[model samples]
Target: MTYSLSDFGSYWAGGEVLCVTEGAPREIAFTRDARFTYDPRGDFAVNAAYVQYFVPAQAVDAPPVLLVHGGGMAGSCWETTPDGRPGWLHRLLDAGRVVHVVDLPERGRAGFAPGHLPGEPILRSMQEAWTLFRFGPAEGFADRTPFAHQQFPVDALEAFARRFVPRWQGTAHLHLAAFLAVLDRTGPALVICHSQGSETAFDAVATNPNRITGLIALEPSAFPDDPAALETCPLVIVQGDHLDSADHWRTRADRWATLADELPDARLIDTAHEVASGGSHMLMMDRHSDQVLEATLGHVRV
Candidate 1:
């Protein structure tokens, strides 16, 4: 498929309204004569999400899409694969659909506020990602061994690892708020979210069911506390392969299945169930990424 864009834009959304007390006046300066009292205590806008959107020249009569990336990642995940291939952003635009990709607060272009959230940032190593993302087995990370049927671009593993950013555990609410803010602008839209982002996306739909009509969850790492909230939303849960190889994914797959069973309009597409050789956790970056995406898109009417 080919891609063309009539327009492109970006913006920041979601932030906290702050109230502060003034500190004792202190002198601070870039130069001796330019010295002035710099009070660090004041109202500040903290933790806002960044969004970039593309408008297809020839548009289809369909809902615009809002993509939310997974944990320790940014909107770049949808821009291109580690191997320098086109990603979901271009693919969807090629199909005549409008797309908005988001960098959740505290990741990517979204700036983080100092001392606002608690706890130090956590960083994931390539070795950990190899196992955590199911690119390969943990035991074989040293030799860079991937699963026999693994479809992730193992050769570009280092490039992929470069995208990993520091994450905080206390930002789920912030993430949800940011997603909700984006939904406020793009209502009745299709939300395509991956991994940890799925949790926030799920809650966003639950919170704004009228605005978010459909969902495409890729290898979701978390779910909402109440499954019944998604009764009115159409959901497609797409999982990668080798789920049974590790308890981490095995448990997640089971939860996804159970959630699908509980929701009337929900379905699960586990690659492991569909083919002998399936995809990895990074479905959009996998070799069969396009096919997986097309299959999932088929379920989204809006």
Candidate 2:
């Protein structure tokens, strides 16, 4: 179903803007097409998460859903699929659910401060995304030889790669702070996190479980250090296909399963094992994303 601005009643955003470091006082000037000239030298605000929220005309009773994208990606990943189909954000909005999408600090709309953070930003190549995302093997990445059950719309892989952005490895703590600040604004939310974002999600909920009613992890790459901290929060862990075929994914999946087993309120959804397969790491953008999301939401009691 198509929707317009009329579908929503209001929208807003909030997050922490941190300045870990400031550039030396240097005279830097710029102009906009020579029509406007201005001096741009000042302390740069770094590691500020960008959050965009949409409130429907009639919202469901459920808590707002917080959608956090994986590493090297922005919140836009939840807005639309590479094939131009409606993503989880739109689907949730269509279902009368309030939705908040977050672009983690140091990425996307949340600009990064050069020379502020420790290490340089790492850029993900097309081949890396092809393989790391479980669409295909590393050797066959150049040829784009996706597995038989690949469901990431391989034809649009190039378009999807466009979502890739430079990500910092040492800024997890900063991202965590910004995420918590977001929760401080939207109380008692249901967080749905993907990949590295899952790490921050786990940390956020662990730090403030009362603010987060539930969490849905999408192919999470990291798990909480203390599982007991998340005992009160409802958890759902979802994984895609071919995990056993790759050590990188297999280890993480196994670790996540172990974490689920330890948590009293945690549920595991291995799409490959439970369903008819064809699910990729990018489960939200997969061919059967609608079903996947529906099933996941069914498990989220809060």
Best model number under TM-score: 1
- Worst 10-residue lDDT window for candidate 2 reads 5-14
TM-scores, each model vs. reference: 0.93, 0.90
lDDT of 2: 0.83
lDDT of candidates 1 onward, in order: 0.87, 0.83
Model 2 clash pairs? Answer: none
Give me the displacement of residue 106 in model 1, in angstroms: 0.6
Candidate 2: tens digits of C-alpha lDDT, residues 185-265 = 888899999999999999997788899999999989888878899999999999888886678877888888898899899
lDDT of 2 at 266: 96
Residue 112, model 1: lDDT of 78
For model 2, the superposed segments whose C-alpha errors exceed 4 Å read 2-42
> What are the per-residue Cα lDDT tens digits for candidate 1 across 184-224?
88767998999999999888877888888799999888897
